[model samples]
Target: MLKSILSFYYQMQVFMFNWIDVEKLVGLFSFEQYDPVVFGTSFFLFYFFAFLFVFRILAKTKDLKVWTIIFFSIFFYYKAAGIYFLLLVFSAIFNFYIGQWIFNSKNENFRRIIFFASIFVNLGVLVYFKYTNFLLEILTDLQVGQFNPLTIFLPIGISFYTFKAMSYVIEIYMEMLEPVKSLRNFSLFIFFFPNVLMGPIDRASEFLPQIEGDFSVSKEDIGRAVFLIIVGLIKKHVIADYIGLNFVDRVFEVPLRFTGTENLLAIYGYSIQIYCDFSGYTDMALGIALLLGFKMRKNFNFPFMANSVMNYWQRWHMSLSLWLLDYLFKPLQMGLRNMRGFGNAFAVLITFTTVGLWHGANWNFVIFGLIHSVFIIFSMLTKPLRTKFYDKVGLANSKVVNFFQIVFTFHLLMFSGVFFRAISFDSALEVFHQVFTFMKPEVFPQFLESNTFIIILIVLGYIGHFTPQKIVDKITSLITRMPVVMQALLIAVVIWIVIQVKSADIQPFIYFQF
Candidate 1:
């Protein structure tokens, strides 16, 4: 028993501490050469310790609490982003101070300069990291490889938090918010751990107030939080992880090896996998924040249920989408108000492409973004024709079009997601070819042979379907009615499950790469 206990602790330590200091490692090995496993492991351990150490120090100190949080946030952000975190801090501090500057500067021209500078500064960093590779390929194709080599790793969450900071700047420019008087709170807004990676891409107006306001947690709220975390765990580790291991990763790694149906299903699985993976991270983030006496914006809202591509974008990664709408789309939308037809189309393409390119410094991400832009643009263009077509068919209100619309949208997403998931343009094209080529009668039978996983997935779907809302409503309404002892026992069970089930296979959050 003693030997077993020691062995357990040893495994835990290995799991936590496996990967650390990537940019440092990359210095020795180069970026492409390091093991993904080692990098992920080091990150897990670094954040785990950082989260614990910061929690204890901040919990005990009032004077240094915010600063302590900010300090550790920077440290962990550094670990997560490598040296690129300097850019994150630079943006945050510059925006924090600039917002204050803008608020105080009553002069119209100076105010305008500050606002423009702030926007330019934020977007410059985003474009530099997010678009560098894209532009590199463009220049290479243009036979101009004279671009300076940038060996710098783009920091994690740069896209998300850059927007968060920009929103702060925008609000100041719009006279909607005063600059943060305290750098501590302002830093906290940008570096808050839960929303740090692959944000719901929270806005300053939404997140800042939560951190500043008083928060209370009930016993049932705790239970609800526990439930959300568990659900999130299953989504990420079980469903997403299994599919990733079994199909999506495999096919993408060697797309020509699989059939059309297999590739198609894998693509479908990946759409769910990514949604489950990403939104699962957000859920865990929210749940963790709840436990810490805070709230975050909901990142997803049953996006698959949307009837249109535009509606799908609105529902998915809502914080990021809304950020784009407020900062990117709306400005362009309003600016092009004078030039209606082509201008609107250009804005839609540019904004959605930017949204796609924001995902990575890759050509595939560009194509993915462009595909989505086309989806939205074509949807918008054909809206009248679609309405008229549905009416003429007398199926406007019929369940058939509704059903087909959902299916069509899901397929559109799956089709585009192939590009999103692929390692290269060729890989995505190969996956598409396999998806078309593998339509034999035997494929479906062979696929459904895994009754165990299918049943488990089905039950998981049912549980995931209703448990969250039911638990949240119940706990929110009747927390006081349940004794603390009961809540404690429930939470204990969840904690145990989290511990026991987290074996050697705890997959890192998928979006951590971006």
Candidate 2:
């Protein structure tokens, strides 16, 4: 009996050792996968709470906190983009030294050269990863020696972090801000992980100080954080994913398969899907940053309520839009200021075209930008005539007239979204063709009946979007006062709803690609 027991124990030990390969175990914990840590995943949630315990302890120690965050952030980037974490390290060190040099330099010509050098390095890397294939395709189309596209691996968050790095140097060159003294502090600012992937695009002027300040989170802050997280989860999982899976994806995937009415509805559905998807990410990012005792700038402000293309840009993706405006549009406009409205028109066109290309390497994005620019320029040029027409019709003061204007603007933006959401330019044109040529009013009722749940959510999403800010603030204030147990229960309820409404496959956040 003793010899049999010894044999069984020996066999069990061998099985355990062989089953768990050490290398595989190490790989799982390392950057073997492209699974970057993102919010709203079960694995991320577990990792975050566990990390939070250690983070809180280190938070009181400034240097320790900064280093700890830097380490974890690097690790987080690795999990998200594998070895691209090294690219982040390279960016941090490179930018830190360059920014300091630019700041400390006294010679005007030298400063200018350094500034352009910074732009070249940052944009050069961006172009290599993001536009090599695009430029290759263009060469092929032009029959320029038939060069094949290279297999360029775009590191995740390259666009975002590169922008962050460029802004740091640019701001120093402009004398708007001083260079950060500590390399570690600068690294923390660029790679806070919360706003690193899809960004509110942290400004050095804004984010740098928070690293050195007191690390404390107020009760209201906790409430706001949880509220934002819940709102984001609902928007992403419940509204965006649900509608995309049920309606928009199908219609967009095969535009000709559906009737014109369905295509139009799909356009409307896509506008909501993108808003929920993007704004949901913003909510979670802001919430997570708040939990960490850092505040992120607002990225969305009820963009769908905008009454004009210009207003839409102002509200939607405010971070990127404003960045382009200050750094890109303003400079270009200044260069052509003598041309008056023509200059403004030129700058607006150029700026938004860049904005479109910033989204992806596609002609569809270019057309998307072009369409909005045309509408905006046309509106600006004809503003006086529009105002006179409104006065002549006695509709200048009419709320009903205002409502129609809002609807018109919303639909115009929705139309532009077709190109933005379509898989290709041909697909987008086909959708437009179907809208005008094959719209069947007779099938509308059946379609509406079949998509009742989706319609309800769409309506609710918009209503919530357009709801007064004060009302939202009031509701959030009340939530902040809830007992811990109640908040826990509310979270449990949210998770249950998410589980119930989630699509079969977890769709990635739309903006993560950018």
Candidate 3:
């Protein structure tokens, strides 16, 4: 009987060991094309919880904490971008050494050479990955060459991290910031996964100092982080995805099939969808960073309420806007200062055009950028006249006037967003054509009845957006004061709602393409 029992146990052990699929287990740590690990996914959540546990254990040892986070970040990137994570490491190393070289060199001529060369190398990689096919298409169109486009895998977040790396080098060259002495810390800045994919484009000057200190997280920070994460979940999975899948995508896909009013509403819907989607991602990123004991700058500020194009740019994607202003526009404007107003105008045109191009490699984006540039120039030129007119009409401080201005500015931006959202220039034009030629106001009742849920969500989104700052602050403060258990319950509820509302297939954030 003892011999029989021992034999049975050995057999069971063999069967149990066989059940473990070693290849599958290894695949979990590697990238899967169909199941790329990203924020808000089940795999990422599991990975994050595991990471948090490890992080807590190592928190007291500063070096261990930093290295642990770095390893986690590397694994995160590898799961997200596969072997391209190596590209990120190479870029980080290259830029780090370049910044140090620029800082240490005293020869002005050599510094300029290194500066331009580094810029070229950085931009060259970006151009090769992002615009090669674009340029090839252009050449084909011109009949200069009929070459086939090459297959190139764009490493996720190349645009964002490249900008961050360039800014680091630029700051050092400009003497505005010092080069990081330790490569490990520099790598952490670039590899920091929180805002890695989409970013407020955190600066080395602002981010590196925090790395020098010990890791810490306060109760208030935890509360705020929870609040922001919950809010982000609602915005993304609830509002943006719901409206987009049901309304905006249908209309934009085939604008001619919808009535003019429906087409117009789709445009408005897209504006809300994109804002909620992009800003939602930003909110989650900020919250995640906070949980890791770091603070990132804010990226948006109720952009829909802007009263002018200038105000809209200031409030919308404020990080990119500020980066452009500080690095591109200001530099160009200074270079052209000899020509005064004409130079300023030229700089604005060029800078905004670059802004549009930066969004994508397409003519529609170019048109979108041009449209903003023209409006911005007009806004600048008419500022004095508008000021005089408001003063003359005694409406400079009129609330009614301000409301109309806000509405008008929003419509202008919404119009530009058509190009931004549409699949092609032709598709964008079709949307406008439908609105202008086939607008059937009589179908409004039917449309409203059919899309009641989407419309209500849109309305609610805008209402939340336009809420006064004080009221929003109060809500955040209330959430922050909640007990830890309450906060956890709140997060759980929000997540449950997200799971219930989310479509069968997860909708990737719109800006991911950019």
Candidate 4:
């Protein structure tokens, strides 16, 4: 009996040990889980509020609050990217110290060297993880010796955080802002989980000041945060994911199988799909930041409302566009100011090219950026001509004229967005050819009938997007003004509705891949 009992105990211990697969646990905590923490996930929705509860308790003690928030942010990032959280901490430490050194160094020459070094280090890590494979492909195509691809997993949000680091160092080098005294504050700025993954690329000047203040939440702030969170959830799960799963993914995956009319409509669907998907992420980021009593810059502004390509860029991805304007376009344009029109055109072209390359390591993204560059440059060159024509036609201030321009500008973006969405140059070319040559008008009705649900969602998305700014604002204001409990109920309802509509598989935010 004693021997049998001992054998049973040994078997139980073996079973318990087998249950814990060390490799699997390591993978779980590593970059193996590529999907970042997003708004709609159960883990986030539940834990975020729990975090807020603890945060509220700590709010009275500013230092404790800051550290608590930092800890939570790190944990949040860990969930999203697993063990790659170490990269985040390393970046924070590296940048914080480098920024301090740059600011403290008395010699301008040394400061300049450190600035360049900072840029090199930050951008080098980014390019290695993001672009190595693309570069290898290019080399392979050129037959420039044998190149083996490296199995490097691109960490989520490296681009945003790298830019955050570079911006911090660049500003310090320029003497624009003082180096932060507290490492905690600087770390919070870089690794603040909400805006880190996808960003309005919060400027240190704008964000750092908030960190020093006492924490407080107003009714308006609560309302606005809840409103944005609900809107973001609907945009992601209800509209973006639904349209993607039903229409956009199917059409893009096998464009050749669909009719030309289907392909053309797919482009339109993608325009709305990407807008809803990306803007959804930004909305959630903004909302989450607001809850933390931090304000992020607006990242989107109803881009479809723009009347020209130049106007479109200003509205779409406003943070990145403005970043390019401030750091890149202004500097290059200033240097080439002597060249006049040629310089302006050159700067615009180069800026968009950088913007394209920043999106991903694809030639397709390059083409996508170039397409916008051409449109914007053409718009610039013809600005006077367009003005003259509008004045000649007595339509300079005409609502009708503005309407047509908005439509034209939107379609131009949609056309460029094909390259943005396509897997390769040849695929984009095939799409272009299909839309131009094989467009069959007769299939529209049947396609609509077959895809009535998706068509409704797509139409609704555009309607919401193009709705007058004032009406949307007023609606948002009213929604946000409800009592706190009512707001929570509203969010609960939205989440429940999302549950009903969401696809079986969660679609990661489109921008998370960037």
Q: Say which candidate scores most in TM-score.
A: 3
List the lowest-lDDT window of 10 residues for candidate 4: 27-36
Write model 2 residue lDDT over 263-355, tens digit each, in one string.
998898899889999999899889988988899888998897787889888899998898889889999999999998999999999998999
**Cα lDDT, model 2, residue 432:** 92
The RMSD (Cα, Å) of candidate 1 is: 7.0
- For model 3, the superposed segments whose C-alpha errors exceed 4 Å read 1-24
Tens-digit lDDT track of model 4 for 1-514: 9999999999988897799887866654444365565778886777788888888874668887898889888888887777788889989999999999998999989888988888888889999999999999899999997788899888888888888777788787778989899999999998898888888788888888999877677777777888788888888889999999988888888777777898988899999999899888888888888888888889888899999999988899898888889888998999999999999999999999999999999898899889988998898899999899989989889999899999998889888988999877888888887888888889999988898999999998898788787986786788777777888899899999999998677888888778
TM-score between candidate 3 and the true structure:
0.96
lDDT of 1 by residue, 308-367 (tens): 788888888888888888878888988998888677888889998887777777778789
> Residue by residue across 197-231, what tens digits does model 3's lDDT show?
77878888899999997769988788789878988
Instruction: lDDT for model 4, please.
Output: 0.86
lDDT of each: 0.72, 0.87, 0.88, 0.86
Provide the TM-score for each candidate, comma-separated.
Answer: 0.83, 0.94, 0.96, 0.93
Give me the displacement of residue 297 in model 3, in angstroms: 1.5
Candidate 1 yields a Cα-based lDDT of 0.72
lDDT of 1 at 214: 46
Distance (Å) between predicted and true CA of 366, model 4?
0.6
